[model samples]
Target chain A: MTNEIARPLFATALRLTRNRDDAEDLVQEALYRGFRSLSTFRKGSRFRAWMFRILHNVFINRVRRQQLAPRATDPADLAPSDHDHPIPDLRDIRELPEVADRHFDERVKAAVDSLPDAFRVPMVLFSLGALSYQEIADALEIPIGTVMSRLHRARRHLRTELADYAREHGLAPDPHAPEGAGS
Target chain B: MKCVEFRAQLFPYLDGELDEAATGTAAAHVADCADCAGRTAFERALEKRLQTALLADVGALDSVALVAAARRSPPLDSPTPASAVSSGVSSSSTGTSSSTRTGRPGHVLRFLTARRLLAVAAALLIAVQAAWFFCIPPFECSYLQAVERTVDAEGTPLRPGVVGPPLAERIEVTPEVLGYRLEGEATVVDLGLGETANSAVRARYAQNGEVVHVVWSDMGGAEPSFRRKREFDGRSWWVATENGHNLVAWMCPVTESLCTLVSELPEERLLDVADKLRAAER
Candidate 1:
């Protein structure tokens, strides 16, 4: 079981925890619990996805005691009209230019790490850990709608960083892609 | 409205968590949009590179190393302060001394004095203890001894009833660094002889030069009792105690003969040995 699922589960987990040491710990812990509860995993479903769900759950529980940053940082000025506060940069991943191409996985980790723990974890589960919005909400004990909005914003943030990375790395916009868009 | 906005939603689109219709619209936009496409591919590559780095060079695991570490004492549960562990005093001092602070305000001078006092106290406590151990000859017996206190007249001795049989002969040593060891002695006694005796009889002995440090000891169960060893006679020499005298058979090889005085050892030595501590900072 370790051999089969180790790669996918760890790859996704590493994305969440960029530090190799922490990722190894997370993978070991997640896999150990996953095997213990293998009886709960129905065989036909995607093992990778199910394992990720478990990992995301394990990560959440491990961090429950950690006081997440008080929504102290600037909430994005471009608040979605429907929300109470300005939407947090759910996908501010693109602003993580140094992490882009340089150490993509590590950048994801750093970006995720910088995210107020509240949004980062849930967002990663939905985006990379491969949990559905409902799965994320259930695992995180948050409402599904919150999971959706955070994920949406996280991706936007990621795009911002990735674009800067492309520009700096001399990677042109997808050539057949667009012109003058660098503006 | 922008390439950045489209790329932000890309991961969610791939996750299929976006509402089906919104997912389709995002997919359609990315397919036609060069900038969004470029951003997604780059981010994906970055993510892949990170995964590879995390997986690489996990280091070869040696089972012997693991087992040896596991068999040693686990880490002590207290935090050691940095000041307590400082090593290598610099060769040159800045020539600063308490008297140098003569003109400073009283509070500042007192603070410096207090720090110097603390350093002196720690140095005396630890460094002095280490020095005392190597420099001083054994002034007192390594431990106190009660000779002839509880031994019986018959040569057969009773076993000390403590955590284990009172007098044990055991030595535990491992071949590697980062290891804990327990070494040295036990004697087996027939419990039938000691049915009425509340303690075990042992002769705790050490050899210094040609003289054997021996003490006739009658010990309560399981407690380690120390007795000055007896002098060695070239041949079999025996000394009498309140209990039956212990007989020592001398041989050319002294250490082996010292061990022959006692028989059976404790059933177990130590427990809960471990390693694998997390790297943490306070």
Candidate 2:
């Protein structure tokens, strides 16, 4: 069962650290701690959520001990907008010709990596489909509303980052409109 | 639903987190409004692309390496401080101490003053006394001596009783058969019988407030001196009591190992356990 979790756990770690060696170290430490505390795991509970929670805690603790800069994005800034607006122009990415190109993947990764830890964590957990909004909230010790707001802003940031790529590929309708205009 | 309501529910609707009513209303709004339909399609495509990018090259991690690292890690429940764990991991990985990582002094100098030396002497004296009081095993002259050491007997006074004969049917003695669950892993204990120091496999079982210990060992031709003996099903069992504890010893027919069961249970229950304990492969 843990074998199945390795890939997604590594993927999440990589997204968080943005460095291969750090990601590997983070995963190894989390898995070690998880195995040692296996006795505390309650039966019939979601193992994915449990493991993800450990990984999240380990990453956060490491960041704190290193005294890295605090989260770049503020929670208030990530709040969902009250007014209605048109969505950003994002064409069906798979239908685009660049979808088959390796550059497309790199572009998406770079855009995701650009997000601050505050927004990036929820985005990675949600995009992995390993957790729900409630599970993300529980893992990050944030409210569900905060989870939703960060996810919304994370995607908004990614759309802005990739707007040039979308326009270059003719995926967007307006060529002259500024990127992230609707957002 | 209006465009405002559809926008509010858009992320949840796409994530399959919306209730039926909200999902249905969002779907209706998207169907009527071309712009809402495009936005929904764009969001779905964006999520799909994000998942693909995030999961790409996840096969790079070595599962075997990860498991090995985990196996090498110390138990989190140990008496070690939590900071020590992080420090240990860092030192193992980077060849550095906690002081190096945190830029703080890791050790302090201490002078053994007269008061400190006296305190150390007092601590050593107390430790020696505690060990003599608790670590010494009870002495028994008979073959029960070996059994006592196997059970780590504290010389509890056994009660005097005559246990009845075993039944004709012989079954293996297992936690399942005795309706008890094994508490933990079975441990190999040294019997310290003679020069050779024979070892026995001891397994403990508990149910509710009662606990039973079963020990299996090769007695090396030692015979029980207990007066009470019973024969049934082509085997004989020696039953004896020391202080308050009851013990039943018999040669297992299947494994040919001397199986001894010790508990504070009544004589009848001990015999019944002996009966059920025989005849199966060990």
Candidate 3:
């Protein structure tokens, strides 16, 4: 029973947190919560969706807590350091063909990570979880149309990101290629 | 259909959810229109790459500890918040109910204490029962214990007898060490996305010399609980009767494989053949 969610839960958490240790912790915490709340789950309900919902809820709560926490700041923290003059941007590095080739996957992953949860959650669930739009809507408690629209928007964003990467490598048609339109 | 319409339907058509006529029409349009063809190809390539990147990055999952953690906890429903029950009771009672509602915080504290006691009791009960189940040795564990149930047979011929058509042009097997022989091309079956195991590989060889059903996946596959007995190579294999049909499933940690061999042959022969097939590659 628990085995069915072990890898997927971890993988989903990993994607959400982008850290292996954090992912494992998130998965374990969600599993414990899901186990406790098992009775609340309707019979014949999708266990995957339920488990994922718990996982997503836990993730969102953690994010909220982190956001609400007050950070202790020293006066020096407000001051800019000479060593922090400027970090080279990945977009700048991506202009080189070999750099783009080596970094495209990372760039795509970073792009995915950068998406706001509204678009990221549904997109990841569809692509990685193999969930249908209805299932995604159920899991996220959103309207089916919202799920579809978010997926469309998310895919478009991913394509644009990949297209930019391709352009960097001279693999795309044009740098100014029109962003394809969809619902 | 216009190229715009065709492009709009590309996702559904690629997903194979389009009506047959629409699919045919879309295919015809793509055949004639280079732009649509390019877009469709790009979408397909993107999906493929996304899948590859996702799976490749899943990394290692420690399943045993996860299963143990799940097995330890009792269902959380018994400890419903006192406020909920009291609120329901108050709703049915008189004006004095308002006073009772005011006491909810205290009621909740008491309830929490009681719930803690109940949880401890339940945990103790669970431990005793779990020990008994394990002592018996042939308990029906959850279906998840049987993971990774298919072979990656891309370009590999499944049927030993049939020479013409092959099973699958693309094979994605989990655990990566499963093998089987099919009796005929007709034995190959379509695997729907819903039916396949998560992050696992599965294929049905409806016919070989004898029918061989194999499913190989990681521990992250879902199914209902069934009678199962653990077995060889530090994994659990179940040979149980489901709906009056004999089903044999194996989860081998040694080789990271889960295989199910189904046959009309007697149990002894079936086990023998399974053993041979399991040991074939290793």
- What residue runs in model 3 are displaced by over 4 Å at the alpha carbon? A1-5, A39-44, A66-102, A173-175, A178-183, B15-38, B64-282
**Candidate 3 per-residue lDDT over residues A34-84, each given as its tens digit:** 655544655334456667788877776656544532134423224344223
Kindly list the per-residue Cα lDDT of model 2 for residues B1-282, writing each as its tens digit: 776667777888887667545666777788898777877886776677667777776655566655443333333333143454454434122212222222322311111232243344346444533432232223111222222222222323232210001110111223331355655534343333322223334445576755555543432222222323344344443343222234443322112222332323466664455444442213
Instruction: Return the number of clashes found in candidate 1.
Output: 48
User: Model 3: what is its DockQ?
Assistant: 0.07
Cα RMSDs of all predictions?
Answer: 27.1, 20.5, 17.0
Write model 1 residue lDDT over B1-282, tens digit each, in one string: 355556556655544446545666776777778766665565555444433433332222233322222222111122122221122111111111112212333434434443444344445444433432233332111221222122232434433322123222111111111121111232222232232221222232333322222211222111121111222333211232111113211110111222222211121210000000000000
Candidate 2 chain B, poorest ten consecutive residues by summed lDDT: B161-170
* Model 1: interface root-mean-square deviation in Å: 22.0
Question: What would the per-residue lDDT of candidate 2 be over residues A1-183, giving only the tens digit for each residue?
Answer: 233467778888878877655566577667655654544554324556777888888888767655553565575564557233334445533355344567778888888887778888898887763577888999987889888878877776777667777677766565336323121
TM-score of chain B of 1: 0.22
Q: Which window of 10 residues has the lowest lDDT sum in candidate 1 chain A?
A: A85-94
Candidate 2 Cα misplacement greater than 4 A, ranges: A69-87, A92-94, A97-100, A169-183, B31-35, B65-282
Q: Which candidate achieves the best TM-score against the true structure?
A: 2
Q: TM-score of B chain for each model?
A: 0.22, 0.30, 0.30
